[model samples]
Target: MTGRSQTEDLARLFAPYESLAATLLGRWDGSIAEGDGSHDRSHLMRVWQLVRRIARGEPAADMEVLVVATLFHDCVAVEKNSPQRAMASRLSADVARRLLDGIGWQPARIEAVAHAIEAHSFSAGIAPRSTEAAILRDADRLDALGALGIARVFYIAGRLGTQLYDPDDPMAERRPLDDRRFALDHFETKLFLLSAGLVTPTGQEIGRQRTALMRAFVEDFGEEIAMPEDLALAD
Candidate 1:
């Protein structure tokens, strides 16, 4: 097959995945409360972009499995610290399986997609066993870093009535880091450590850069809010 024809064929094969994503997103629109913007349709789409990029770097990655998994990875969004947080991915996997079965996806393909979704969440604590699952996990975590990650942190914190930082101990020098109370605590608790957990080399490189950006912002923020005593202590 010619290069152009191969490209066309690939596009034709991928079109339905994109269509299903859009259809599901339309149904999800406005169903979530305004404050839950962090896990909205846009987030899923961004993760899809990363999944494509990461999949390109993995010769054995199953694109169809990755695409379907990315679309429904967060089909059922829950609060960060909710009691059901760990079950979110499993619920989403079930939803994706039912939806894929309805659309006549092969049993093997549906199982692949379901496993990828089930293993994608940080809270779920399930290790990814497939290339597609690993890519999905890395893609989702990548969104929780960099400038966009900064915006999401504050957005969710504001919605939950959390402070920007702990006034007395912004870096939590004397206390345990609690992201539920201060947005900045999230950097120390989670965001800064994501790169180490990434499975793909492409994702790890991107994650390293984004993590640095988050670290720089945290340093700048600390400087901006430093008290005389804090500055003196640093000296």
Candidate 2:
């Protein structure tokens, strides 16, 4: 899609919170010089959609905090394979703190938003300490579990020059699983495990549904590729 069209679409998505969207979008453009398909504005919008859905089940969550946190959760773009990947959430949280401070937000509220942004990351390993943080964390991760998750896996693998799977052992029946070398391995290494770790009940429920789809995709892939009968049986 054209850049203008994407911007217009995002504008419509965030129209309910114009002021916060304006500030967040401006900061986002300034932060990421080169955006990837997987973590661009579209990703933010999807996560926001999920956050809103999850928040409906969580009455105690602060909508404003979730909005701002969702917008800035990945303000700093870090490659998935980067050594600094784990610090991406912390860096994004710092940017969120500065932007909220500039807008004269209360320290406590800013901290709340910052905490949600900081803990939303999978690699960060920071537990969500509040309702908002937990909701944001669950929402962000939910985006990485389903159809979008499937698309993103291959997209990133192509970018990283990884294989679709091992030609001789697509399901890794005889070889060790390595996501860095094969895209399909990631389903086992991370995606399938996400649903069980989800913090919110809503997120967990959605994750289970999505992950089941992912598992079905993997099974179909194995069958289509005609995995050896013995190996398939072992799997």
Candidate 3:
């Protein structure tokens, strides 16, 4: 989707929290528009969808917190391969705290939002401490699975100029898995393992479904690339 369309969708999705959403969209729209395809507006919209879906089962979650957290979760864009990638969520939470505090949100609520934003990142290695945080984490990670996740893996690889896979050893039977150098290796490196780490039951169920799809894709991908004798297709 075009950035403008995605922004419009975000405006609608967060319509209940219009004032805060407007403030964020106005300030971050340019950055989001210029960001890599994997972390752009469409990705936010998808995460919002998952947040709502997961929240239904997690009735204790604070929607306002989810709303603001989703809006600023990736406010600070860092490339996946950057040394600073692990700090991206922390940096975004800091920005969210400043913005929400400026808007007069209560300290506790702002902290809730910030925590959700901070704990949502896979690279951050922080355990979620609240229902909102767990839901947001699961929601965001859900976007990194399934068909959408597959597309993002390659989209980011193209941005980094990485090969589709290491042609000599596509499955990395000898070489270590290096997603920075080969896109397909990312499945085993992270994507394939995401479902098992999901926090919410709802998110876990959906994650399992999506992960199955991704698994099938990788199996097919393997068959197409590997030599006949080397192939050991699953029964």
Candidate 4:
């Protein structure tokens, strides 16, 4: 058998982990509660779904590990639009270990999952280890694209209440954005950076399409702002 099939067979052994993972994810009351737009369960589920689809093409990827890692990746995200990248990475590793233990995953497998979760943070600056890790990383980044990303930006901005860009307002005086700065700045801050970091072929393709869509959206948004009379995508 090819290595891909072998990995698939191995994953079958972990078929019983879904419930355990869902239970653990339900406990993630971090940023979502306070309305931080960074990462939430809805976001987590979307990434989890994307990772699963990627694994279908690259069966060598471990579904169980990626599922668990993605679900728990941002369990400790910044508190409502803060830059808590380091803390999120650290907390995800700890939480992944605990959840994996409760599910009785092998010690080695648990450690691998923990390592992948901790290192998957973009700011953590660690390269991916397993295909599972790469998939998880790509999937996480994918969540920051297209319409979902737009909603996230405004949702976060509203919570933080940051203002839009201002040629006159001092840059240093701006608070971390809540809603206003999000529309103007998302293109540069996060959305524009995702396509390059995507790892899987399937993910990269989707990222490309989403990037095009987002760029168009941003350009049009700019026009709408310049005139405030031509709201094309308002519907």
Which candidate leads the pack in lDDT? 3
lDDT score, candidate 4: 0.66
What ranges in model 4 sit over 4 Å off?
1-17, 22-38, 80-83, 167-183, 227-235
Each prediction's RMSD over C-alphas, in Å, is 6.8, 3.5, 4.0, 8.9
lDDT of 3 by residue, 200-233 (tens): 9999999999999999999999888876663544
Candidate 4 lDDT over residue span 1-235, tens digit each: 1244433442333345655544554444333212343564456557767877777878787766776777667766555445665667777788778767876789998988887787777777778878888888777777778777767666666666665544332222355532335455656666788798888898899899888888887777665555233543462
* Model 3 weakest 10-residue run by lDDT: 26-35
| Local lDDT at 109 for model 4 | 89
lDDT of 3 at 180: 82
Ranking by TM-score: 3, 2, 1, 4
Poorest 10 consecutive residues by lDDT, candidate 2: 25-34
Instruction: List the candidate 2 regions with Cα displacement exceeding 4 Å.
Output: 1-12, 24-34, 227-235
**lDDT (0 to 1) per candidate:** 0.79, 0.85, 0.86, 0.66
lDDT against true structure, model 2: 0.85
- lDDT by residue for model 2 (1-235), tens: 2354454565567657766766655544454323688888678778889998998899989888988888778878888999999999999899888888888999999999999999888899999999999999998888888899999999999898999998877888899999999999999999998888898889989998999999999999888888577986998
Q: Candidate 1 regions off by >4 Å?
A: 1-16, 19-35, 229-235
Model 1 worst lDDT window (10 residues): 26-35
TM-score, per-candidate, Cα-based: 0.84, 0.89, 0.90, 0.74
Cα shift from native, residue 149, model 2 (Å): 0.9
